[model samples]
Target: MKIHKEGFGTIITSTIIAAAIIVPTVLLVMPLYPVLGWITVIAILGLLVFILSFFRIPGRQHADGEDLIVSPCDGTVVVMEEVEADEYFKDRRLQLSIFMSPLNVHVNRNPVSGEVTYSQYHKGKYLVAWHPKSSTENERHSVVYKSGDKEVLVKQIAGALAKRIVNYLKPGDKVKQSEEMGFIKFGSRVDLLLPIGTKIEVQMNQKVKGGVTVLAKW
Candidate 1:
């Protein structure tokens, strides 16, 4: 319901655009150059793009169950593969990968309520979100929450354009479903590896709201 301050990068971009236009108008208007006026228009357009990227849409759903499964990130479902998870799960799982573009909201949330059982940061390569090798190659933060008799592992992977990944939770930190856990810079992807036989309520290509839509149910 509230639009928080945008990331520092986004704020800097907006500031550059605003100053490029308004500052010149106040200091260089004496010359009355027509070229500068046109430039001002372009700069203002850039500011709008920065605003859109920082805007946050209100969530439309809430959690009401002991094991509710909220969407881990705001993005379109691009992949649902049967792959063996790297850690924690170790077994084959239904890996639901959501590709978050630079335009998508980068805030990630807890999908279920539980204790933080495992958390690890892997410094690796920055690959494309959809790249099959990205799951192993990308710089990723892996966090596992043991909730309702199941262990849910959420991996925040930084893509080629993303340079920073922020995870706010730590060991023993009790996270609630839909609570803000971290934010990914620019663009990246979040992969949720669910246990086999878990009921998935989302379709492949469906747009999901982080902390809102239930991707699955135990």
Candidate 2:
């Protein structure tokens, strides 16, 4: 369990903030108001831990098979159904949506190994991750991967609490399955559009781990 590269700045900032409060509470406030200062210390510690955990990158072995689709991020499956894709596909596709809470790992992994064919970032609103409109209306980045004759799309969406999104892949780049694609700071959502007729391996509301969970097989 290592601190994810994406959280270096965040962890440092969080540490400074936590220490500012914790040090003062321990050295001065605690001497005067023991109960109140101790509570403040504990609260600061909890917040620091949460921030560290959010950026943690746990080791994981990606799902096997080039045809298997792995989860892009750790979160709960919020939407799974056939939907009309208004983006690249412009046709009906099976969509799987994952909602990432602050408690979940924020690293977005590649669902499949392929050459990136389409990559775009959109400026938009910051609604809650589960909001239906957030998938399209929220600040997001979309990347499509192609392997052989199959192509899949993944979108990283910003939620009400998430304001920053980091995507490293661009068109023409070849990415490996389960490799880092992006990181969404704080809470967010990820949408995966699979080819029609693909088998859905997970159900709605199911919790999934990034890189480790098999979403479906192409």
Alpha carbon lDDT of residue 83, candidate 1?
A: 88
lDDT by residue (tens digit), candidate 2, 1-218: 99888889988998998888898789999999999998999988998888889889888777767879999999999998899997899889999999999999899999998899999999999999999999889999999999889999999999999999999998999988888899999999999999999998899899999999999998
List clashing residue pairs in candidate 1: none
What is the TM-score (0 to 1) of candidate 1? 0.87
Candidate 2 lDDT (Cα, 0 to 1) = 0.92
**What's the TM-score of every candidate structure?**
0.87, 0.97
RMSD, candidate 2, Å? 1.0
Off by over 4 Å in 2: none
Tens-digit lDDT track of model 1 for 40-123? 766777766666555555655666567578888889998887887778776898889899987887788899998998889999
User: lDDT of all the models against the reference?
Assistant: 0.82, 0.92
